[model samples]
Target: MIRAELPPYEGDTAHLRKMFSYFPSGVVALLANVGGTPKGMVASSFTVGVSMEPPLVSCAIRRQSSTWPELKGAHRIGISVFGEDQGEMARQISSKSIASRFEKIPLRHADSSALFIAQAPVWFECSFADELPAGDHTIALLEVHRGGADPELPPLVFYGSTFRQLQVSSADG
Candidate 1:
């Protein structure tokens, strides 16, 4: 094995950050009912289609997050793939104040284990499968029991510390 010493450079943090920010990702709000109370947080690193045979999706969350403890107890998880209109809700859930989160959003009970919100472009009712710690955050792998999306709705995207709405190109235009 061979290793080379890298040269020191200024603004390395900004350069590294810009590199990661170039990769756009969809935002998801994960919710779980713990002791009949709903706990949720917005995450930008959620990815779909981990496995096709059994069907799986995963989300990465920091180990020290306050919401992760309560959410882990849920038998299943509610995954809301946000539409463009839900960006406000995403910010609310991402806020440090937990007491007021989800106070304004309408949630419905789904799978007897999670809460589903209306108007989400895509929704998933998934059973908690397992979690693996990777550096500062844990990767939670979920088995997708059921999921669906509205074709006409657009997705909520996050990039470079800002939220973006997905624009579809229509052939008729």
Candidate 2:
């Protein structure tokens, strides 16, 4: 059996991204209504069910993010699970210029002021719970206020440095 030689790892940013790319995660849209303008960004680091008793979820944000400050002021934030067909929308929201993130996208908003993509398979309405710095990022913990899902719309998966679609095997059914 031939074993591949490993590169000398420095445990730097480059290596970290390369190694973590092997683990696929769901793509999510973090949205909020800041004042009268819609603000949002795409995150592959979103996680759910962090605390069952408190009903919490979390998303890791870069410490240098300029959007976090404005979003934190919102009364509530929306987390929309991207569908397999929304890869383009994800990139648009994550772009450098935040001015036009939702230019052509359809959106829905809850009474709590949490904005969401109308077609997302699932979405959560949450309020700021807590956050703590972790290395170069801050984990934003949120307490779920309300959420819903549509099983018919399958979620988008971010893996191997690209957006991929998911397929459920018949055996699982």
Number of the predicted model whose lDDT against the real structure is largest: 2
- Candidate 2 deviant stretches above 4 angstroms: 1-9
* Every candidate's lDDT: 0.85, 0.92
Residue-wise C-alpha lDDT for candidate 1, range 78-165, written one tens digit per residue? 9998888888889988899888997888887775778777788899998888899998889999889877889778888998878998
Per-prediction TM-score to the true structure, in the order listed: 0.88, 0.93
Expressed as tens digits, the lDDT of each residue in 1-173 for candidate 2 is: 99999877776877789789879999999899888999988899999989998999999999999998888779999999999999999999999977788899899998877999989999999998899999999999999989999999999999999999997999976
Model 2 gets an lDDT of 0.92
**Model 1 misplacement above 4 A:** 1-14
